[model samples]
Target: MSDLNPRETVQDALYRAARDLEARGVGYAMRDARRLMTHALGIASDRLTLFLREPLPAEAAGVFTAFCERRAAREPVSRIVEGRLFFGRWFKVTPEVLDPRPETEVLIDQALRFQFGSFLDIGTGSGCIAVTLLAERARANAFVTDISERALKIAEENALAHSVSERARFATSDWFSDVVGQFDLIVSNPPYIRPSEMETLEPEVLKGDPHIALTDFVDGLTGYRQIAAHAEKHLVPGGRVLVEIGPDEAQEVVQLFTDAGLTNCTVYQDFDRRDRVVEAFSTKPSKIG
Candidate 1:
């Protein structure tokens, strides 16, 4: 570890923290170290690099050590830092929600390409998707729903922070149970990870992320089933549904959408070239009960 002398410069502290994290095998060690230092010192990351020779305050050193210990234990950096940047905005995150992932940005891109007056986000953890959409498309009306009240609160806060609260609404719904109106675009990054595979996820996710937001009890496709089954009713004719799915699940999920009467379904890949988001449109309205 770099010398922890109270008189060491801020840059030195960051370097020491980064080295410590790297030795501990933490992913994104350098980035996490910089973030932790910035949080503890109340200095911008860019500035931290320039002040390497500057000594950190004694109290800041203590807080930085605590932050490093948490990160060393595999706690998500977002959780450790209390905020995560997504789609050019910072979102507050806690144990109540899943840390937003870059792969989900694919969903945003897909949404932007489509012509939709209104959007609905199912399982809107942290409201990242809904908030980003509203920020990007100012005229688009959006609603975000999550089964967990805590998650919904975070999403609401995010909406307000991003200045999109008026354009977006929050509701506590289990899928579409309480949603009343039809939307032209319905998007979700639901709990698609299979119960059986939960054990195989990274420690940061399996142990640190919210369990309810990361799983579907039956074969990991339950959320897709509910969304596909109910989407036609909640979506206007020709309205589309876009969802992020696990790799190798695209084919199965596509079939589920087809069986549910959604037509012209297609799977899109994320940056890693893995099958990721699925998009489908309702072709004909099913007979209402």
Candidate 2:
């Protein structure tokens, strides 16, 4: 069914992969096709154009076809590639952890605005949040928690990859149950999707992501409530919390933060101007403040 010949040029092979993906309605088919092709060929993406006329090695072409088949079946390219770019750095990804999302980078942006001696990340899937913080704020150490030990291990691997392993500690716990430190900045991109909403996510998303990382399987407010209730107790005075949230859940979540005694609550929008992050100051003002 492919237009590829027995000895097709790299471009022809790549084009055929894209065409096949497009036919299957794979969103971002062309881009993913190129990624799959380059990764399969073990070549740099920028080198793709240069190899257009070169015949793809038979082995590489076969690998490309397999990757294309997986893509057509709707596996996320990031998951298939086992890595994703978050906060401008690549973090290893796996089915055990959540594939880091670009929108969640807002947590990094907002947290960087304040100075913190220590950081806490709840549900630190893949360690993207915790490791990136430690990498950026060289002076800060982090305590990251996850309910899934498997996910915590993935986060630990990513922390090592980002060279933040020395500054990060990963724990398996339900929320803050076993967390031991007080932190100046507590952040999370928790499971905020509601149960019913889970069924509506894109097929690729549902397939490539861990269900535990995707939804609370509740009204989506469960994580918010627990974080709000416990985060304040674990924060250093005047500490701040910046949480990624469902766009429409801002008002309720803000109230939960307020109820937990976090002050100066503010909701921030993503680049698209949808409410994406909520920030609040702990009730006890620090001497440093």
Candidate 3:
């Protein structure tokens, strides 16, 4: 309402919003402002530069300012935009699910490196992992499970949006409780943050994200332990399990897999050189007593 169209162009509004966001200590302020302006005004950021003398409608300016406020309060851009791009596909995201981070792509890359016919994504959240696998390997069968019904719904919508719904299945379960049969590949990006460390995470993560999907009540390895313990049963012989873990959790997770009798346990680093993923495979078929 502050004369957002005072002979200034959309580019001027963007720069002002970026300055406001920067003043509030929002990371990626310039980038987020540009994206918000593009989304609200329906114009590309590059195009805005060419129309610097064009004025933004009052309504558009109002919406853009509100977006800047939310972002300044540490709300994730994904939540504000209601979607994010993962593996070159747009995925619907919400407060109910953790925003899909680039680090998780390491899991997908690892999965594609192996020969597998079927895959399971435990704690699927927005179904980014499952849908990506299905879309990339058209013949692959994939299933995703989430404890939160709301999260599952978002995942389903994403699967359908990405045109992988037919090849993807959604279920509500606490880990593998309702999963049936064995899969050749099982992957997860489960809650791996320790309770004590949760307080230290960025405000956008600590306040805006769902805590249940970010941390486990115990030592932060609870999900990994459960997955490793039961993976041998839910996975075909020689089937591998891939998981994204906290940077400090790599060694502990590798030990858990080893203790569960999974062989060839290994950890991979992400772009930031953090130990970000763990991979292991079942040694032999074992009957559950």
**All predictions: root-mean-square deviation over Cα?**
1.8, 2.2, 1.9
Pairs of residues at least 3 apart in sequence or in different chains that clash in candidate 1: 8-54, 8-55, 9-53, 9-54, 9-55, 10-54, 11-52
Whose TM-score is greatest here? 2
For residues 1-289, could you state the per-residue lDDT of candidate 1 as single tens digits? 4337787777777777888888888878888888898888887766876656667889989898899888988888889888898998899998999999999999999989977789899999999999999999889999789999999999999999989999887899998888878889999999988888988898999767898888877788989999988999888889999999999899999999999999899889999999999999987864444
For each candidate in the order shown, give its overall lDDT on alpha carbons: 0.88, 0.87, 0.87
- Model 1 earns a TM-score of 0.95
Residues 1-289 of candidate 3: C-alpha lDDT, one tens digit per residue: 2336555678788888888888889888889988888767866546766655678877887788788888888888888888888998889999999899999999889989967789999999988899999999989988889999999999999989988898877899998889887789999999999889987999988876899999986789989988987899988888899999999998899999999899999899999999999999897875553
Best by lDDT: 1
Task: Kindly list the per-residue Cα lDDT of model 2 for residues 94-169, writing each as its tens digit.
Answer: 9999999888888889998878889889999898999988999998999889999999999999888888898887
Q: Positional deviation of 263 in candidate 3, in angstroms?
A: 0.8
